[model samples]
Target: MPAFTIVTTSATQDSDAAEVNTLTDDFGSETEALGYSRRMADEMLGLAAQLSLDFDYSNVALYDGDLLEEDLDPDHPALIGVWVLDEEGCSYVPAAEFRESLAEPEA
Candidate 1:
């Protein structure tokens, strides 16, 4: 099974907070991540529309095990790798790309 790290950012009372979480449950390829990201983005978009919140893709990120070191730089501008998996009795999609692609339009 491929390992992945999930980076999440949340708005706080004073500022923003970022954290990284690692997962080895499934996922074994980039393709899986891409598909998963798309689906998640779609769902989040729908939720935002219903709640009238500014929903964007920057809220999520996925990292590959190779990139998920104990001392990963938080300011890096590259994607951390993620593994994709294909199991006979399970299905999952990674969502790293969706977060990376969330950019506001230029004024």
Candidate 2:
């Protein structure tokens, strides 16, 4: 069972959202997280849409907190992927790509 972390913070609070967004629950796996997140999908979508957050292609993200911890450095190439919110509704973005986007300047 893979450990999953839920990034829970109202999008309105950007600073608060960035700091320690992970939930206390340690989900067993992506499948498990998916199941639980699906139940709260509406709420998640509301938050994401409100903030226009890129965190998850979807609103609720089952972030692999363990994997993210293992690759804390943005420069690392072995980082795993996570969900992000996009126009398509939801999708997964590799860690490296996500970090790079974060590092880049917004037009």
Q: Write the per-residue lDDT of candidate 2 for residues 41-66, one digit (tens) a residue.
A: 55666666787654422334445555
Give the per-residue lDDT digits (tens) of candidate 1, residues 1-107: 66555543322233354333433334767567555644554554455457655422223445555455545433344445322211111122233543343343556
What's the lDDT for all of these models?
0.42, 0.53
Give candidate 1's whole-model lDDT.
0.42
Model 2 TM-score is: 0.45
lDDT of 2: 0.53
Q: Pick the candidate with the highest lDDT.
A: 2
- Per-prediction TM-score: 0.46, 0.45
In model 2, the runs with Cα more than 4 Å from the true position are: 13-21, 26-28, 34-41, 46-61, 65-82, 86-88
The list of candidate 1 runs beyond 4 A from truth reads 10-24, 66-78, 81-107
